[model samples]
Target chain A: MAPEERLIAVGVSHHTAPLEVRERLAVAADSIPTLLTRLRDDGFSNETVLLSTCNRVELYSVPGVRGDANGLARWLAETGGVMGRDVESTIYRLHDQAALHHIFRVVSSLDSVVLGEPEIVGQFKKAYRLSQESNAAGPVMHRVMDRALAVAKKVRTETNIAREAVSVGRAGVELARQVLGSLEGRSALLIGAGDHGKVVARSLLGYGLTEIVVANRTFGNAVNLAQQFKGSAIPLHEVERYFPRVDVVICSTGAGKILIDRDQLAGAVSKRRGRSLVMIDLAVPRNIDPGVNDLGGVYRFDLDDLAQIAGRGKEAREVAAEEAERIVESESERYWRQIMNEVVTQRIGTIVQTADAVRVAELERLRSTLDGLEPDQVAAVDAMTRAIVKKLLHQPLHQVRTWAREGEIESVESLFTAFGTRKEDDV
Target chain B: MGSVLTIASIVTILVPVRARRLAQKNNAPGGIAAHRNWEFVAVGLILLGLLLMGMQSDVLPMLTVQGGLRTLALFVAIGWLVLRRKEKMAAAGMILLPMAAVLLVSSLLEPPHAVATSVGSPFFTTHVALVFLGLGGFALSFALSTLFLIQRRRLKRKQFEDIGQLPSMETLDLLNFRTQCLGFAALTAGVAMGVFLLTQSASGRGLGDITVWGTCAVWFWYAAGLHARVVLGWRGRTAAVFGVVGFGSLGAVLTVVTVVFGGWHGS
Candidate 1:
């Protein structure tokens, strides 16, 4: 047997760890190349892709030698500044087919904290690219990553697994579009120029939002982001002044106090003459007042409210997720079967070479005698000998293919021995 | 052959219901593909039904009650195929497929009379074609309005199940407005042609016929809707409600005039 190279995976996900733990373990996008290089330097795995997102941080690897999971787990602990046992307690280790299945699920977003969220696939792609760039990905990693991505695409095309927006940024955009009908000819005031606020602004812009006003505590950062979208920037204090003029408000500031209170929104509603206003608070401390939703013309959605909508989105994708899982399972099985066939074909190379050598020796011995015959007779003899060689090898080759397909390596070994070819000789 | 069409239409109706249930169960994409396939089959069957109808008659008259209903159903089916090409309009099949099936069944149940009661002139045929085609546009507007209402309600309730699959309220309202505009124009041309044909025939019934007055009333009602929408900038719920009312009235009048009176001009 070709020393069975095992595909392994170890990870700390939202399911196994808290947000703080995930954050501590999260690898920055710029650091991925260095991290992958370091993993190889530390002799953790021969091939690897490190995927780190807000919801999960996972390492998928193909080991150069058997039982390399422990070393990889230790490396993960060191990277996160935690004890080995602490990381081990929270980490999940999967081997072979289980490891492959987990990778497919992760890439497909089936294993995401928010089921069917689309970010994971992009994150996975980035990790694969970084791994390749760092020379951490080899043939095994290439095969697994390629199949994982193909499976993800198949799931997306053949199923409705990612039909809805499960993230707050997108769900907020969806709510705004639903309420206000269209974003065309509509203006939005983003209350913070932070990352989440930028995401929300982008989502709104995708819906043809005509105008955007970006407001942040730091006026320079606000101006920078506003320039990107061809919009104006305002200081944080002027959010209420811009509120009535804008139809949507997306706030993600780090402010401790409520930025838009009920009184502020109620006054804005009157100023706008009861035109609908959509408020989304993506801040951790809740930037918009919850009481603002009670106002007749003001619609408010906090992170929790967005989560509720995302939950509904998740519910609507459950059936499609099931269908996606089946696709992943079948693809993974087919991939493993292909890998096994290649390995078996490699093992049987010497037997085929031996048969070829015998046929060539006999043909060479008869070549001299056939030289006395006509040129056509010599050509005929060559053709007959080639046919004989093919017929002689056909049964054995068929048995080898069938045995490899059935995963019967022992039968293959016995069959080789019966043919007077030892497995060691093939090596 | 007609029975085959009926069976196909029934299957088409059931497919959308299944698609809706699948969407509710969260496999909306699969449901959408299946619904689209069944609708294509329904369109083929409807064309076959028209072929059978043509074989039965010397001329393929779309003005006859049965022909009008089937042709209208065909338009609706084709409309749905076009609309459902957008992901946001995928849910349209659940509403439209069944409406098409109902019209198909209505056409099947009430076959047109073998002998023509009304005068068959080129002008009369053109008028009938225009009028039914206009009605088909009205039917499309009605379906869009219904979708807008459902989408609006879901948004109000914060239910995001169909929100992603449904077009925004603005899109639906705009589509409804455009279709109704076309329908209004066609109806105006159709009614004008009818008046000319009536004068030429000298039927003597003149404006006394219920068909003449009723057609005028229905046309004026839809024309008012178009007027309110375009000139006054009326939209959203107002336009949606007008679409439902205007199309509903046209449907009621057509049903009564065609089935009860048994004549093109209420003879």
Candidate 2:
């Protein structure tokens, strides 16, 4: 009814927009309902759905697009409360088939914060459901989303996209535990309350450690962490006091300098009789010296050093991934073919409706002539005529479908060209 | 079976090596893919080799065939490890493949030799199986421990992100401990079964050995070690130390029983 429509995306993603622009245009989920309503009311979006994740903010729409696709551009500029030129500098516009394929790829987690992550599937489902509820999706958008979701499900179940490495924090705690095996009666001193460091602290606690002490440069952050873990919140000034008692030290402060150098850790471990101290340096410039690893039982894991150890089982997982990709590709192809069939059905209905008028008049005349004819014979004639019409339409419809697979309009144009047709009046 | 195995071995190893080298030379982004294909080759080789060594023993003088099979497997296992040096599974896999190769080959040297006690008993056969299973588990744990140590060393230098391709240290470490615990549990089962077999053999057929007693004692040591590691929170280098000691004792018991006591428990 809306005519066969083309889908398009005009937006910014983490790849296209730098952090500054991405944060600027990042529409919160809570405000999406009102924003979307305002957009549709502005008459630029015949169909609208917004994918607003931390990594990206995409606007999917169906044409007839308003004002040469510049309308959505203006809308984005307005919504972010920025100038059109600034938005244009960072925005990317993908047209028709590319837009549809892009969304499909995104849902598959090909464009994720971490490659092969599982979170994108849940995000895509939530976005689709929200748009559907908002009454912002038309028949075409609904079909595309349903197909995209199916592809996402297929990719996850069929491929190794969901397999994950241990989080960075988990890596820190594991190295510490491996180096100094017994932590049952040991004390762990934690610094920095970054998300990564918190995960490390949690892992250590889970491994059945006795005491955890929190200390951060900002005393409040340390206190908050200590409160959460039900541990001692020592003053930042006394960070060195707790270091000697802690058998394991995990540091992840944002400060540039070494929080605990080789000398500081040596002093602590020596006071404790060189009793197998594990020091984890999670700071960027490195909180602990690389030389500290040479000391007996003083194992230090820095970010750059963990790579060789992680390569072991990666080969096996990569093997499983190939098998998975073949499955997703085949399913995506099948879904695209189905969408083409629906489009063909729309075209066939229009052609048949015009034929129906002539056919009904001819059938009425035949019925009067065949009043003496048997009911079975009359029914056979009706079937024969219907079959003729179907046969006549088959070749053109097949060609149109083949073209639809390439893009929606090629075969239709070819069919129009075949009859030496140029205008709607000619049809 | 022999021909199939030999061909499979060559194809699996040789083709994969060449393919990997080619991929590396090409700077193929599919370098990871080349390594995966190598796994298929490895699986094929191992399965075929194991089957060949198994099927050859039915009619022949099993001892000769068994000894020959063991030697071949041991060599190939080590070779496989060296070839896939970059493979993370290679370390633990190296120990497993060789141990299996040696044990299977030796077991066939005298068919059902475990049951050759003074009196026939199912308990003895069960005990022998339990011992091998435990030993295999321990071997796996040993391999995992080695992997854990290597991973730990890399992590200390802060090279994880730089290497970009390795599995995380946390995962390898966890896998190592879990495997160690598994090995320990199997060893405990081995001890239980051996004690049961010993009592039954003594009461019924009256066969006894100091090595069997020693093996039983080693089992307890491993059981205690595992308990400390799992519950008492013994970790990392400490766990590796225990594994080496426990596995070494088990190895010593095995050597004593095999080389010193040629007395067959033939079924």
Instruction: Choose the strongest candidate by lDDT.
Output: 1
Against the native chain B, each candidate's TM-score is: 0.90, 0.62
lDDT of 1 by residue, A46-87 (tens): 788998765678899876543377667777877878775766
The C-alpha stretches of model 2 lying farther than 4 A from their native spots are A1-5, A63-70, A82-89, A164-326, A358-395, A405-408, A413-427, B1-267
User: Could you give candidate 2's per-residue lDDT for residues B75-170 as a string of tens digits?
Assistant: 344434543453444344435544544454454454332224423344544454455455556665666666666665664555453233334444
Candidate 2 C-alpha lDDT tens digits along A9-113: 778876777645765676756677787777677667767788876467888887433523566766776787766686676777766555666787788766554
* Deviation (Å) of A417 in candidate 2: 11
TM-score of chain A of 2: 0.58
Residue pairs clashing in model 1 are none
